[model samples]
Target: MTDATLDRIAGALAGMVLGDALGVPGELWPREKVRSRFGRIEEFLDGPADNIVACYFKAGHYTDDSAQAFVVLEALLKAGTVPPAKTLADDLLEWVRSMNGFEINLLGPSSKASLLAWSKGEDAEAVTKLSLTNGAAMRIAPVGCLVEANEHEKLAETVARVSRVTHSTDVAISGAAMVAQAVASAVAGRSWDEIRTDIAAIHPIALVKGEPTWAASVLARLEAFEAMVEKLGDAPSEEDVSLLIYRAIGTGTMTSESVAAALAVALWCRDPWLAAVMCANMGGDTDTMGAMACAICGAKCGISGMDESVVKYLETTNGIDFRALAKRILEARANFTIGD
Candidate 1:
């Protein structure tokens, strides 16, 4: 693979970890609380002792978002593409098993529920029947980088195949597909307008009986992002931006909200570290939003744009070699060619 392509992949992965760690301490806090506690999260801070979920981890530690994405990365490296649903399901189940006693795992509701069903020997389809959460979109960075540019079908199918193992509902799958496509576009150096167009083109598919879809919600978030950005201007205060995102757009773990929040942050920050900082301070589901936004910005800017010390610190602390992961993904990328 070309060095440029590899750099983009590495940047995307490293950005994910950095964002996750940076946001760990601030997860779930409301904008008001976040502002009062830190003013603005300009650096990594340990999870506060009083916060229930945050206390499970320390500063500079990533939550299940990056951990699960790492699992997905390993699976993609082994399978060289989107693995079979059963195979992916097994892999995810094993991840839950490995984290059996570790409360820090912090698996999201959707993934936790689906894995619990799998552990009970339920069929995969049944396990995924009620999973309309952001869990699917949070861990789909590998698929984004591996999908060749302009290959929307490959992107969508790959996202669906992986997402269905944990999140089969229309909103989850659609959000995941949009994220993967946006990452692909970022890897190809597409403009924000092009990426936005790609995201807006996604169609939600209802796969299960009685499960509601978020097609309208997803579209509305997209428009909300555009409107918010137009009004916020290029240099809104961090407080103003955080409050707007939390109250106006919502920052919870829901796919319709968090994924769109990530996109909005990416468009506004346009830089990996800046995006990470902003999303970290925005509060609810901070790590996932930060990782998602930073991944996209990293794709646009490449790893060289990051601080060398911070990257090195993340690699040393997290025990993840993003460069090696990028290399493996590049190998997998070569095995599957997308047709124009």
Candidate 2:
């Protein structure tokens, strides 16, 4: 990989960590509670808070989002690309089965469901029918990076293969595909407008078409997503911008509303720091949103786009050196040919 490519990967990885850490503190707070408690979320504050991170004195510790992302990264490294559905399912199940000690912290709800089914001797294809959670989208960002510059078909297939092992709902698969495609576009240096437009075109069938249930809500909220994207155009104040989007959109549910809210934070930020902080503070499902936002901004700006404070905090708290992880992934990529 070229130095620039490595730098971009590093930035994105760091952005993921930064976002995970930032969002950890406000994971389940309602919008009003978040606003009342934090008074407009900006920067990592040390104190009691509803989010998991506040339980620790340090900053930057990651939750299931970043940890599962690393699992996806590991799978990509070993498989040499996005594996096919059966292969992906087997690999993920094997990984989960091998978990011992500290590795237990990484599995999520959808993954847990799949693992339990597998343990009970269920078929992989049949097991996936049990879940409809955000677990698929949460870990699939690495697929975006792994298949950089690929078209929507390739991206969608990769996401679907990985997702169907656990998250088979159209909403989960579509959300994963959208995130992967968006990250891939960003990595290819596409403009944000282009990324959004491309995502809209890629998933026309999956966009909301009916009442606002979890499955249909992401599509139903398109107008609100577009509005937030528009508001982010002027480079508004980070605090004001985050609140505006949070109030206008919201960060609840596993649907598109949450994804759009996270994307709004990334789109509005002048840098990865602001993106991570803003997404983290939106409360419910904060870590997942933060991680997704980090992936988007990090792909666009590279590691230099992040704040030193954020990087330091993540390393100290999470015991994960995101920059090193990026370098390792780049090295792995260099050793394999495109079709290998």
Quick one: best TM-score, which candidate? 1
| Model 2 alpha-carbon drift over 4 Å, by segment | 40-58, 83-109, 123-127, 204-214, 217-220, 228-244, 331-340
* TM, every model: 0.91, 0.80
Question: Model 2, range 4-103, lDDT digits (tens) per residue?
Answer: 7766777777777777767765666776677777776566655353344344334546666776778777877887766555566555666565644124
Q: What RMSD does each model have against the real structure? A: 2.9, 4.5
- What number of clashing residue pairs does each candidate have, in the order they appear? 0, 3
lDDT of 1 by residue, 1-340 (tens): 3788888888998888888889888788887798798887888889888777777777777777888888877887777666777777788778777767234546887788777767677875664656667898899877889888677767777777778878887778777777777777888878888877877765343122114654346557868867875697877775677677778788898888898788778877788899899888887989999888888888878888789899888888888787888888777886864233
lDDT per model, in order?
0.78, 0.66
* lDDT over C-alpha atoms for residue 184 of model 1: 79
Model 1 scores worst on lDDT over the 10 consecutive residues at 202-211
